[model samples]
Target: MLIGVPAETMAGETRVAVTPETTKKLMAQGHSVRVQSGAGVAASVTDAAYQAAGADMTDAAGALGCDLVLKVRSPSALELTQMKPGAALVGMLNPFDAEGLQRLASARLTAFALEAAPRTTRAQSMDVLSSQANIAGYKAVIMAADRYQKFFPMLMTAAGTVKAARVVILGVGVAGLQAIATAKRLGAVIEASDVRPSVKEQVESLGAKFIDVPYETAEEKEAAEGVGGYARPMPQSWLDRQKLEVAKRVAQADVVISTALIPGRAAPVLITEEMVASMKPGSVIIDMAAGKGAVNADGSVGGNCPLTEADKTVVKHGVTLVGETNLAALVAADASALYARNVLDFLKLVLPKDAAGIEVPLDDDIVAACLMTQGGEIKKT
Candidate 1:
């Protein structure tokens, strides 16, 4: 079996799908690996390094036209044309994009979108979302620290005493939890909020305050419990209450990092225009959910804050909003290494060690959930 690693064509995508470490591993398993020249350049991995690992350095066409192709992002129409029918593709393909899946199906390619993998213990090694989100969360704090004019830690110098920066993190998911931990390490006073009540302990354990909004109704409680390890949409009543609580914190906060996002749904607004207006003049916000949120009339999408512009950092109402969509890509080297390992782990389920051909085990829950387009048809809705 031959595997290809193509350079990511998406703008702002600096991470590659495979690294020299994974290349060697694949070769040891009786598979030949072909990596396009400059595929890992952005990730700081060199062609010489890949060659040393026994990988064939090839052109984009040579890499794309393989029996199995690994990618960081979905292929473009032009790149898709280079692939042969019945070839296998694996990537962080957006499973919710029906048109994209249709395109893969039309190409007669077997596509596996790793983003759709189940959040189970058995699938933890292949969980791309968690791995990427962890990087995003850490970077969010680092970016916030850089943008913030005030010091994160309190200072008592020969002059006067300086207060520690107050940071409020919205959506206590993997990213949010990481943000809290990073902020705490920087000596910032942190507070986090989420619809799921169960994360309060996790928040408190990280030495950050959890903004608790008691569920008033049964529906709110049920929603707060969440589904499948992800937070469900909270009732409007609960949201209103959370808004009021968050607004108070935002007013006093020096930095805000919002990571709230529901899969396949518009990100719920946690910080409103009014909330932004209330914040201090030099306050900074890292909207991790930017480009995945509500689409505005002006053809721009927002994150946890409606004022946030995707992939742009701007000051509106005296608040600096950092709307980077791909924070993990900013940390390219480690992100690529982790993502490549995830791709390798996922391949274990599809590619047998002893066999020369790939096999899709439909009975495997993770494989079944991730299988998007196979056999000239879309397998996942």
Candidate 2:
């Protein structure tokens, strides 16, 4: 099979879909791997390195025209024209975008969006969300600490004693848990909140206090249970109670990291403008779910915090909001390396081990869930 790795064209996106380590693995599996010239440049991988791994270096058109096209972001319209009919594409293509799916269908391309894979033990090895979210979570704390005026760890000086920074993490997903772990290592006092009551143990296990919002009604309890290990949208009553509980923490918090997100939905407004107003001056917030590709009336994508303006760092109510969306892109090398492994794992379902061809197993659950468009039809799993 001919596998192509194209350079990401999205502005400010530095990560590539494939890395040198995975390139050699694919070559050993009897596949011809071709990468666009300078595709891995941003990830600090050079053309020579890919060549050393036995990959042919080519141009954008040449790379996109392969039997299998790999990418970090979804292909743009111009890029679609470069691909051949009936070619297969695999990457983190945004499955939520109806228009993009239509384009892919029109092109008669068999497209796989890895983000749509189910969250099961069997699918864990190929879980792109967890791998990238882990990076986002770790980077969130680092970026928050860098932006804050005070140190994360408490200090004792001859002149005086410096108190440890208080941090509040919202949404206890893979990213939020990692954020807590990262902050704890930095010696910060941590408190976290999540709709699911089950995660309280996870928070306490990490030595952080869990801010619990009790379910007053059966509806709230049922909603909190969520699906596939993801939190469902809570009832307004619970949300109100949560806001009141979170407001108190926000006012006293020196740093805030919001990682809340529901798949296929706009990120819930966890941190409101009022919460930002009450936070301490010089505090920093890293919204990993910022600018989640939602265009606002003002023509800008909003972040988890109401005050956040996407992709920009601004001080609102004396609190700094870091609204960069591509947190995984910041750690490009590891992100690509991990993502490449996931792609390779997923390819095994379609490509046989012995030969240079693909036989996509459409009946497989993981493959079915990820098949956004096949044979010019948007399949519903």
Candidate 3:
């Protein structure tokens, strides 16, 4: 099989879907690898490095016209024109984008949106969300620390004492948990909240306080549990109670990192204007859910905070809001490396080790969930 790795064309996107290490493995497995010249340059992977690892450096059109194409973002209209029909494509294709899926289906491409994969034991290695979210969580805290005027740790000087920063994390998923752990390492007092009750132990294990908004009704309890390890939208009654609890913590917080999101849904408003107004003047907010989430009525990026402008940093209510959507892309090297490995793991399911053909197993849950488009139809699950 011929495999292509193309340069990402999304604004501010620096991640590549394939790296030299993974390229080498595929080349050794009787696969012909084609990479766009300088595809991995932003990630510090030189063209010569890819060549050394047995990849044929080619133009974007050349690479796109292959048996299989791997990318970080979905192809643009021009790119779609260059691809061969029936060719396979794998990437974090933003499955929520109905129009994008439709375009891909119209092109008759067999597409796999990796973000849609199940979070099961067998699919762990191929979990792109967890791998990338881990990086975003760590980077969010770093962004907060940079914007904050004071130190995270308390200091006792001969002149005076500097108090430790109070950090709050919303949506204690993989990213939220990492935010707590990262803030704790910086000597800040951390508090985290999530709809799911199971993560309380995970939060406590990391030495952070878990903000509990107990479910008042059975419906709230069921919704709070979430589905397939991803969060579900909560009832308004529960959300109102949560807001009350979080508002109290936000008032005194030095840093707030919001990671709350429901898959294929607009990001919930976790940090409201009122909450932002009450925070300290020098406090920082790193909204990791900025541009990647918030599917509006017209399908624009909405954020955890309604005031958050995607990919832009805003100073509101005398507080700093770091609404950077590409925190993982900021650390492009490792993020692409981990994502490339995840893609490689998923390939084992469809691409044969010894043969030259791609096989899509409909019986496999991972494959079925990821197969958004096949045979010119939107086969969304």
Candidate 4:
């Protein structure tokens, strides 16, 4: 089978879908690969490296016109429209995007959403969320560090003793945990919180204090574990209590990182205007869910946007708010490697017995599970 890896067309996107390392693995499995010229350059993976790994470099048309297509995000309409009927596409497809969904249906392609991968033990290694979030979490801290005026670690100098920066992390998932660990490593006095009780130990293990506030038992536990063990929406009451409790801490912290998200749903607005205003000037807030409208303050809302820097954007609450667009792209090589692994694992399950051919197995659980649309129909829960 020929696997196509095209350059990511999304603005601010620098990560490639496939890397030389993964291309080598694919070739070892008897799969031929075609990467769009310069696809891996931004991620620092050279075309020469891909050639050495047994991948053929070509133009977008040649690459996209393959047996299977792998992408970082859904392709542009022009790209999707060019797909041959029955060609397979797998990636982090935003199933809820109405226009994109419609274009996908019109293509009559076998499409899989990596975000829809089942959360099971067998699927752990193939989990793009975990792999990508790991990098995102690490990058969030770096972004916070850059925005913050004060140093993270405590310092002793001839001038005087400088105290460590106080860092707070909200949401203790893979990204949250990574943020906690990264902040701690930088010598920050970190405090972490999550609605789920299961992560208290995980937070404390990283030498960060855990914040526990009062809330209704049902809402508390449910919000912590999130929906389907994925992040979920929080009730107004719990959110109200959280705003109050977290405001005081935010006011004092040097940096705050918000890593809350719900799969295929909008990100919850964990911080309000009061929360941002309460914080001292020069404090930083990295809203990981900003792309999903998850960041909101009294006057401003943060979520994913088509906004570019020239838009004269302002984080007005005296808080520097960064809505990370493609944090994983900051570390392209690893991101591509992990993304390819997920694509490869998924192919192994969906591919036909004959290496050269594969039928869209609509009846298969993994197929039905990840396939968002087929035959002009949307298969969604």
Candidate 5:
């Protein structure tokens, strides 16, 4: 089977679908790999590296026509037009987005949305969202640290002793945990909070204090768990309580990294403009959920770290608002490697000769979990 790897076309996306290392593995399994020329360049992977791994380098159109296509994001209409009708596409197609679903269905191709990969044990290896979020979380801390005026760690200098920076992490999931760990590594006084109390242990494992807010009912608890482990919309009462607690913490923290997300829903505004105004001016707030929408007033959309206009640099409250989309792309090389491994592991169950004779068994859990649309019909949720 010839598997295609195309360069990411999504604006600001730097990661590619397949890395040279993963290409080598597929080739060793007797699978042919074709990579679009310069696909791995942003990730610092060279065309020569792909060639060395036994992957044929070609143009985007040519690569899209392979037996199977792996991509970092959904391909554009022009790119999809190049694919053969029966070709298989495996990638994070943003299934929740209506436009994305419509395009894939129109293509009449077998599409697997990695974003919909189930949380079951068998599907763990192919969980692209978790893998990417892990990197994003780690990098978010670094980004916050860079913007922060003071050092994360306390230090004794000739002048005086500086106190350790207070870091607050919201969301406490894969990304939030990683952020906590990274900040702690830098010697910051780390504290974290999440709607789900289950992650308290994970936050404390890295020596960060866990800020837990108990809910009154089972329904509230269930909603906190969120769809596919993402956060769900909270009630006004819950949000009010959360704001009161978070406001105190925000005022104390030198840095705040927010990673809370609710799938198929607008990102909840965990930090309000008034809250941002309450913080000391030099504090940094990194909003990981910025990919969905603005987390604060004057919020810029569509970047890994969206910044307000240069001239309008409202530095009054001394808070730095960071909303970067696609933080994983910042570490493209490592990100691509992890993503490629995820796709390869999943494909092992349903590709090559195995794909040849078997009509996509709709009953298969992996297939059922990720198949968003088939035979021109969108599967009911």
Candidate 6:
């Protein structure tokens, strides 16, 4: 099998799909690896590194034209043009992007969107969402600490004693839980809220207070239980109650990090403009859900906060809002390593080590869920 690693062309995408560590493993599996020159540059893996791992360094065309193409993101239209019709593509392709899937089908590519994989225990090693979100969660806290005017930990100095920063984390998922853990390490007083009630124990275990909004009905409880390890859309009544509870915490918080996102839906507005206004002047907010939230009339999308500007840091109501769309990319080296391993694990299900060609076993739930396009058609859709 010929495996190719192409440089990511998407803006702000710094991670690569394959690292030298993974390349060596692929070579051990009787695969010929071809990596585009500088494909791993952004992730700190040099051409010499790939060569040392027995990978052939090639140009974009040589890499993308291979039998199997590994990518950090979905290819652009121009990139798709460079690929062979029947070549297989693997990436964290957005499965919800109907237009993108249509384009892959049109290109006659055997596309696999890893994000669609199930959240079962067997799929944990290949879970790109969890791996990337873990990095994002850690970075969000570091970013907040850098931008925040006060110290996360209280200090007893010769001049005066400084109070510890109050940190509030919204969405207690992979990202939010990481934020709580990170913030706790920084000695901040942390509080986290999530639609899922099961995460409350996890939050408390991390030394963060769980902001609870009692479920009013059976429907609310079921929705709060969530589906497939992801949060479902809570009823409006619950959201309203949560908003009130969150607003109280937001008013006193020195740092707020929101990681709430329902798959395939606009990120719910957890922090409104009014909430921002009530926050302390020097408070910092890291909106991890940026660029996937509600669209404004001006055609701008926000995160958990409507005031958040994607990829931009701005001050609204004297509070600083940091809306970094790709927080995982900021920590490129580790992010690439984890993502590459995910790609490698996913390949085992399709590309057998003892066999020559790939196999799309639709009977396998993980493979079926990730199969975006196959045989000149969109399979998962």
- Top candidate by lDDT: 6
lDDT of 2: 0.90
Two-way TM-score contest, 2 vs 5, winner = 2
lDDT tens digits, residue span 1-381, model 4: 888998888887788888887888888878889999999898888899999999999999988888799998998988986678778888888867767777787887778888777777777777888999999999989988988888999999999999999998988999999999999999999988777777889899899998886667775666756554576666778777777777778788888888777665666666766677778888888877765663334434455321211213246567777776678888887888788787778777777445676565777666667887777766664
- Model 4: what TM-score? 0.91
Error of 4 at 303 (Å): 3.6
**Model 5 residue 99 CA deviation in Å:** 1.3
RMSD of 1: 0.8
Model 2, residue 273: what's the lDDT?
81
Q: Which 10 residues in a row give candidate 2 its minimum summed lDDT?
A: 293-302
Predictions in order: lDDT: 0.94, 0.90, 0.92, 0.79, 0.80, 0.95
Clashing pairs in 2: 1-356
Q: In model 3, which range of ten residues has the least summed lDDT?
A: 293-302
Q: What is the TM-score of candidate 5?
A: 0.91
lDDT string for model 1 (1-381, tens) is: 989999999999999999999999999999999999999999999999999999999999999999999999999999999999999999988998999989999999999999999899999999999999999999999999999998999999999999999999999999999999999999999999999989999999999999999988999999999888898998999888888999999999999999999998999888899899999899999999898889888888898888898899999998899999999999999999999999999999999889877798899999999999988999978
- Give, for candidate 5, the lowest lDDT window spanning 10 residues: 302-311
Q: Per-prediction TM-score, please?
A: 0.99, 0.97, 0.96, 0.91, 0.91, 0.99
Q: With candidate 1 superimposed using the best TM-score fit, by how many Å does residue 365's alpha carbon deviate from the native? A: 0.4
Q: What RMSD does model 4 have?
A: 3.0
Shift of residue 323 alpha carbon in model 5, Å: 1.4
**Superposed Cα RMSD, model 6:** 0.8
